[model samples]
Structure formats: C-alpha cells, structure tokens
Target: MVARGRVLVIEEVPSQETFALWDGVRAEGWDVTAAPLAATVDAVRRAAPDVVVLNLHGAGDADRRALYLQAAGRLALTRTPRRPPILLVGDAGPDEKPLGVADVIRGPYSARHVAQRIGSLSRLSTMQQEMMRRVETAGQYGVVPPELEPSNQFHEPKVLVVGAGIRYFAIERTLARRATLVGAFTVDTALDYLERQAFDCVVLNMRVQEAAEFTARLRRNVDHFALPVVVLADPREVDEVDAAYAAGADDVVFHSGESAIFAERVATVLKEHRLRESLKAAYARSRDRATNDALTGLFARGFLLDHLSRMVEAAAHGGRLSIVGFRIANIDEVNRQHGYAAGDHLIRQVGTVIGRLVRGEDLAARPGGGRFVIVLPDTHVDDAAGVAARLGAVLRATRFALPGASEPVSAEVVSAVADRIDGDDAESLVARVTL
Candidate 1:
C-alpha cells in the first residue's frame, strides 16, 4: 500500500508505549521513523517527515522546554517547502503554549487518536504547500494572489453543541468567550441547525452510541464530511473512546471537568480547520479567466498542462502522481438528438459535479468538449482509480433535462486512470488516460 505520509517520532529514551504508537501508526498506513532526541535535527532533515511527534513523558519541565525549542529551531532553519507541525505527546502545562507546537495530546489516549491527529496535520501541511505553489503559478498569468497575512477582521466561529447534560454546559461555558454557541438537545435538532446555517465545529456530548451514529451520519454528507467534531466521553470507558474514533470524530475529549484543557484541545482543531478554509478561499480567489475554462470554471487546458509539467518534475524525487480522464461517451449523441445548447448545459452540469467532488488540492481541467482531466499529486493509482470510479458513477446516475424532451436524459461516462512512471512527461502521462 502507498504510505499515507511520513511521521518522525523524537524520544530521548524510547519506551514500549512509543514503539506501540509507531506500530499502530504504521498499521494505519503511515511510514513512521523513530529518532533519539540528540539526533532530532538530523533525522528531521533527512526524513523530511510530514509531521513530527515529540515524546517528553518522562522529561523534566526544563528538559521538555529545551527539547521543544531545539526541535522548533531546527525546523525553522530547515529550508523546506512546508515545515511539519510538531505534536507534543505529553502534558506541556496549561499555560505553556509554545510556538510551532501544533497540538498537545495529554493524559491517557489511544494510538488511533494520535494517528488521526497526525493525519490531519499532514494533510494541512500538504494543502499549505500546494496553495503556495498554485498562488505563485497563478501570478505568472497576471492573476492577483490574495494577501498572505491574516486579516485584521475577526469572525467568531459558530459551534453547535449536540446534546444536554453537564458536559454540554461545560462546552458552552468554555466557548462562550471565544465563539458563538447554539445548543441542540436532539440529533434531529442538530441536523436541522446544520441545514439552516453553517457551523465551524460540532461538540457531541451525548452517549457514545448516539454520538457515533451522529458522526457517521455527518460524514456521509459531502458538505459536512470535513467539519470538525469533538466527542465528549468518560476516560474510564475505554470502549467509548474507541467507538468515537472509529466513527470519525476529529477529537475525542475525555471529560474530567477540566474545561481549560478541553478549551485548548478544541481551539487546536478549530485553528487547523479555519486555516484550511482560508487556504482554499485564497486559492479560489487566485483563479482567473486566463487560467480557468469559461464554461467549466476549472483550469484551462493550457494551465493544466503547465502545472502538470511542474508536478512531473517534482515527482522525480520520490512521490506518487496520478491523472484521471473523464469522457462523456454519449455527449455527441445527445447534442445531435437534443440541440447543441442542451449538450452544453449537460457538460456544464457535469463540470460542476466534478469540481464539487474533487479535493481542493486536486486540479481539474476541461480540455474542451466532453473530456475532463484531474491531476492528483501524492495520490497512488489505486486511490486515483477509486476517485475516477466514484465520479463516473455519480455522473451516470445524474439525469439531465433537455429543452424539448419531456423525459430527462442520462449520461454514459467513461473514466480512465494512470500513474506516472519512470520517464513520463506531462503530455505523455495525460495521454495514457485521455487518449
């Protein structure tokens, strides 16, 4: 299997728990490497991990601070495309919020939870790097890039609390000063609130079974799949904690009445979520008519080829890259039967669906007519095939309304996927699938 990403763990004295964490993360499809604290800088520079986990469980306060500073300094000095976020594996004190520390996983927690955090941080790092490159590329086309600095204007995050009881009150009180809170006592009420308005995150304070069900339901919806979710559970109940992570909870907080710690954890997740949203928005703003297809609102054919050439060169240094081609097999027939206008409408609708289905980092382009292509960097052929199949299925299922026909028309979509091999140029890679 293709590795999800690389993870480097720094520990002065490795323990069984640390080894177990590596094993679990490796099983979760991440390539994990362990390095002594003394070699932290060298290991990080050599491995170039997507994220770093520093274990200071047995270190003194001074030692912990020094180790973190050392790691942060090395990361700052290293000239990488994106600096990996550091995850402190031990308690870093309530008020000791150090720079460069993405998050702190305190107290007793399962390896799965840590792995999930690593995955999120890794993806965030990749997205940030991609955004920078895309912005730079767009600048070449005379598209003005969005300002990189954080906006002075602040928007209070809106949070939905789904459940009642002491934990709900604790969450509400903790976020009262920092966010806008809306309480939903029942699952139905929460779902209704979600439909009515947008929320930055959702805190589930109900029973584990109910919360798990609710999280699964939210994951099924395309709009809410990436929404942050925090499941409140009793630390003593190990089963509940496992269930929460299994159901795709972003963070499972063990409720011990420590509202301060809870607040910090929630804040970490919220910050990451907001940063991701901002990057996506910035990239969208950088798109111009010169680089985007007129009807599809996707990258123009020329822009896609230029970007793919750069990606092909970068993939030379150990990485996976895949391209997917989508063809509306019966588009010509539809145009002849119903008018060219109806055919254009059908193509436009299909393009919209492709844009919505693809990830923010994936580049989708309409090379004219019913042919579209998507470039997925850091994605293996199997995963790219899965994405292609899903897009094809959705397109096939969609019914299109024609101008004169009483019955809606259906589509026949043909999809092909190809991975970059040893000696492949952008044109050659795209041709393998599109041709």
Candidate 2:
C-alpha cells in the first residue's frame, strides 16, 4: 500500500517519544520526516508535506511566535501553493490556542490519538479543496450542484452482498436491522440483480477473486455510479484495504471485527449515499419540470418538437412513426361560460385518458394552449388512427366531474393523425397533423 500524504515533523531536539510518535504515523501509511526547528521553513519548501507537525514542548511565547512566523513564511514559497495544515503539540488546553495551527493536541496524547487528529485534519482539508473545485467547475459550466434536504425518514435500505462466505451471513444478519440484505454468489449474478433492481449499497468481500474488478465495473456502470460500496476483508488480509479503496470502495471493514462495528460503518456509508442520491433525484425532477408541461405532466412544446425531429430521421430509414394532434372541441366555449377552472378540468381529464391509452413506448404531451400531441414510435398511420379514435370517443362520451359543478360536464374531442412522409421534417409532420 502506498502512503497517501506526507507529514513533516519540526522538533528542535528529537526525543525517543517524539521518534516513536513519528514511527507510528509511518505505520499508518503516511510519508513522515523529521526536521530541526531552525530548518522548518526550508524543509517545508523542499518536502512540500501535506501537513506540518510542530512540537511546541518547553517553548516560550517568543519562541512560539517566531516558529509561527517561520511557518507562515513557507506559505509564500513558490513550491507551496497553499498553506499546509499544522498540528501543534504541547502541554496546553483548548484555552491555549496556537497562532499558526489548524488544531492543537494537549500533552499525554497517545500515538493513535495524534495520528487520528492528523488524519481528520487531512480529510477536512481534502473536503474543503473538493468543494472549492466543485464551485469553480459549476461557475464554468453554468450549473450548480443541487442542495439536498436532510431526511430523517428511514426506509429499509436494500443491500447486496457479493461473494460467498461466513462474513456474508454475518453482514446479512447485522445489516438486517435497517437494510434488506440480498446475497449474490458471483459478480455476474450481482450485476444481473443490479440491472433488474436498484440496491442502495453493496457489501463486497475482499476474499472474492473478482471483488476489485467488480468494484471498478460497478463504479463505471451508469445506473450504479452513485451507489455506495463497502469492502469487507478478513483480519489476516488487512493489507488488502488499500486495494479496496483504490477500486472505489467507500469504506472497508474487517470481517473479524465486531458485528456492530460492521453495521455502523455500513449505516454511515448509506447515510451519505442516500444524501447524494436525493440530490441527484431532485436535479432530475427539476430537469423534467423544465422540459415538461406543468398542467398536463407531459412534454412541453420545445422538447416534443426535438423528439419529433429525431423520430423523423429514424422514419426515413423505414421506421414507422405516427403523430396524433388532438384538442378539446368546445374548450373556448367551456372557458367562456364556466370559467378557466372548467376548461382546465376538461383538459386534465383528457390528458388522463390519453395517458391510460398510450403504450409505454409512446409519448403523450400537452404541447401548447388547449392542444395535445402523442408521438408513437414504430407505429403505422392506421394504428395511430385507431388509438386517436378510441381516445376521442372515450373523451367525448365520458362526463368529466368538475369542482363545484351541478352536473358532470360533457365534452367532445377532435383529432387528426399524420404519418411521416418521404420528405417530411419535424415541423412538416406536426403541421400536417394540426392542419
């Protein structure tokens, strides 16, 4: 496993305890080096560590101020684009804050405690950089990331367990508290299930020969791109954790650990994944609203025309395409006599009827004022006419129940059907049907 970040330790006189602490950080897969306090700025300029660890042991106020000034100088060096996060270690409480550090660790700190603080500060810095990058990208692209609302409502999250082992069973039992766990003995089976249905997260076992490949492929898949993956490894195989992360695993858990820990890790990953999925779903809904009519819940005029254009090209290659233009025959009179509400009620009822009649492959849209259009791909003129006639007859005979109406209001539908001509375009086809 390769180290992720470099850490530079600045200590005027290195003690055994300080060296031990540096060794512990190295064990955690961080590139760490020691430098004398006098050479701190020059070392920082050369090494360009992701973070600087300053030992303020037995230092006076003047010394602390001078060290902070040196650290600040490194920020202006050409090699360092931004100031690296600094951790000040001394016998101090929260009240004794350092001038040039992101965080402070009071004395009597264990190696693990120091490493954990460094890791957290590093991750926070990474997140901040990522956010700034997203903001810049959004400015360039003219589209901002959607802000999603936090939801406390818990639905049973669906989890897919890949590969066969005792860990799978343990995960199944543990995750069942909040998730519905389904097992896939092989990667192919997992993909088949994924294609057929959506899974909120995948618990992948590192022991599976293809687990790494599976994670890569899963991330590449469009449907599962945002889906969270948690890789599980046996304690003996802890070295595989780096591979799991490289393969796009969101979190890795050792199967030998407590079942509760496994469950909690899974839950945390799921919470974040669900937040992202909510944002994406919201963005999709906003896009749909932009391209669709609010009144009829159908494609708007511009979008409908764009579809027509593509279908026309396909029709030229011997594909069948049909368009049906329909309107409420007495919509004007209904609006004049009963009011806009009655007219709107009539149109909505007609849309409902058309929606029920059209096949899943067909598109029904309220393209403009008091008019609707249905695009039937791979449909002949006769088939389109039959559909239009059925819709027209049903709409004319069915009495639409309107709000505050004495009786159900009866209405008539007038429709025209047009098939793609040899030289037809989107405009011509739509014009023919409406004319």
Candidate 3:
C-alpha cells in the first residue's frame, strides 16, 4: 500500500533487537524509526510519519485510554505541512490495557497484519473528496447527485399561473424559464407534505392563503428544521418582508418582479446549502474518528456508555439484566511467539463466537480495550454465569494456527459475570464482576 510519509515507533523498549526484527518492514521500503515512549509527539513532529506505532508497557485501562487520546489528539490537532494517518501498535506488554483503538495490535500480533493495516490506512486516505461528500450525504439525506435537479421539480408554473392574476402570471412565466415549479400554494393551503420528504428548498405563495397561517407553519418548520424557502406574497403585503425573513424565508417576492428572479434566489440558497453540508460532513467524520475504532466497526467508548446506561434503565423497569466481562490471557504470548496477524485473527474469532452465543436482545461490545462485555437482558445470575463458562470453554476448545510458530495457539480466558440484584444499576452490576 502507498503512504504519504514514514512510520515512527514509540514504545517502552524500542531496543536495537526490536528494530532489527522489524527490518523486514524497512526492507519493504518503509522508513521506520524508533523513539522513546514519552517522545511520541516529538517523534511524530520530527519524522512526520504516516503511522505511529506504540510499544505499550502494561499500562492500566485508565492510562491506556489517556495515552490513546493523547496520541489521537496529536494526530488530529497538530496540522502539519503534510499530515499522515496515525496507526498504533499496541503489542508491547501482556495484560496491558489498550484503547481498542487506532490499529491496535495486542501481544503476538503478526508482522504481515501490521504492514497491511498501515498500507490500508494510507489507501483509505486517497478516497476522493467528492466520493466522501456523497457518502456523508447518503447517511443523512437519501439522495443521488444527478437526481437533485429532477427531484426539485415540484409543479407546472404555467398551470399555477392560470388562477392568480395577470401580474402574478407574468412573474410565473419569468420563473418558468429558470426553475421547475414545485407544488404551488395560493391562500388557504401551505405545504403539508414537506414534513414527510426531503426537500432542498420550499416555495410558498401567500397570494391565496393567509400569510399569517402559512408563515406560522413556516416558522414552526424553521423551529423544527433548516430548509431554504422562498415566500411569494401580494405586492401590497411587501411590508411583511421582515416577518417573512424572520419566519425563515430565504427570499420573499411579490408582483414587484417576474418569477425568473425568484427562481434565481432559490438556486443561490441551494448552492450555499451544499457548502454547509460539506462542512457538517467533515465535522461529523472527525468527531466519529475521535472515539471510534475503525477496524472492528464497533461503537466508541462514549457511545457504548450512553447506550448501556439507557439499557440499564430499561432493564430496571422492564426486568432483570446480566452482564459479563471477559479477557483472553496467553494471547499476547501467542503473538510474540508467532506474530500479530495471528493474534488479530484470534481476537476476531473470539468476538464472533461470543456474538453468536448471545441472545438476540443482548449487546456485545468492546469498550476501548481488549476487554469485551456482554449485556443480557432478562437474564438471571445463574444464566449469566453459565453463558460465561460456555464462552470460556469455547476459547479453551478453539485452536488457531500461528505465523512462524511450532504449534497452534489458543486462549486462556478469565471472565466475570453478574446480574442485577435489588436496585443495582449498570455501574454496580459491572462492579459485581470485580466482587
């Protein structure tokens, strides 16, 4: 894969021996360098590497989280002359808490897996900005790019002009040249359908309906959403232009000019909106990257807490809840004996087997570390324990192939399970595993 810059390694023990072993990566034409763990940001600044590999030293969960954020923040805020993606290597120690973030590789990670992750992150950076925009919009607005114009066509300007007045008819004719008339509204009726569908712009003519009611609904919409609007009013009520704008009208037109000008104003607003969408999309992407781990496609730490908290509340009123936290021991040894890629394969295998073992209503999530927690609703303590034992047995039974290793590697699991007792909440339930 192609990268924009070199990769810098920051770890507790970036010994000459470690560097020698990783020379295969250097052989692949990657400029790999090592620096002291505390000098992560400094190394990043000097090397300006595409990826940052961390050699953790058995830090606790809190420390691991803080470190992950520290590195992630450095990557995000320190705008360089040239920015490269940050890839973290978390294979430094056994029982070390990892953020489950930034290309995390626990102990025993495969060298090939590490190389592939670095390569893939670089390739992902080459994703086209236009394609990014399209993707960003798809999640929020169900729209196709070419269909934007055709979709905006609401009604026939000619047919709409048949009733209003001679001056209005002239205005409609002018508008007909530049814009496709969407649904037209006279005095009594305003748009009731906009609430249901996505619209880039809305056109409301107050000539037929009372301006106050129509404006009221428009104002309600303004309170509810952000959509560009053009209000058509009687020339006599031009004094209401201030109110129209206040009520969220982008442009207000009367018999003062033709419909052509009205259409032009609407088009301008839509163009501005496209820019707003881009900014919003980029902001959202950065925010998502902040807490989310891209590899497993799991919810971020904050999201998981908010979600599980809500689940706990629901479980309080609805029924009992059980939760289990599990960790795989000896996997780190496997990675060191074999390679990180094999370790990653085992993690995925564990995740899959545990996912399949749970009930449909239950939730299984990794909260920022290698630690996996499963929440089972309406489950008793005994059942929760049984599930945990079954999961442990699965880990014990499953055999995995390793890279550059003599024998197959499997997991040794230590798990804790608990159920709601009395009015116990999420934090307390989770603490039960500790008890």
RMSD to true structure for each model, in Å? 3.5, 19.4, 26.5
Local accuracy by lDDT, each model: 0.78, 0.67, 0.52
Off by over 4 Å in 1: 58-65, 78-82, 148-153, 207-212, 219-222, 234-249, 320-337, 379-402, 405-421, 431-435
The model with the greatest TM-score is 1
Candidate 2 Cα misplacement greater than 4 A, ranges? 1-147, 151-154, 206-209, 278-435
Candidate 2 vs candidate 3: which has greater TM-score? 2
Write down the lDDT that model 1 would get.
Answer: 0.78
lDDT tens string, model 2, 1-435?
225467888877677777787897787657889887768777887786777887766345766646654664454453554457787776544344445666666544445446655754564454344334333333433545455444334578889988886667777777777888889988889889999987889988647235667876765544564467887766665545556555556766666546665675577667655554443343334335546677776667776676677667755653467899997778888888788898898788777666555543466778776788988765557657766775666567678887656788887678999888788898888887663
- TM per candidate comes to 0.84, 0.39, 0.32
User: Mind sharing the TM-score for model 1?
Assistant: 0.84
Residue 228 error for model 3, in Å?
54
lDDT of 3 at 288: 46
lDDT of 2: 0.67
What order do candidates take by lDDT, descending? Answer: 1, 2, 3
Which residue runs does candidate 3 get wrong by more than 4 Å?
A: 1-300, 422-428, 431-435
Q: Which of the numbered candidates is closest to the native, going by highest lDDT? A: 1
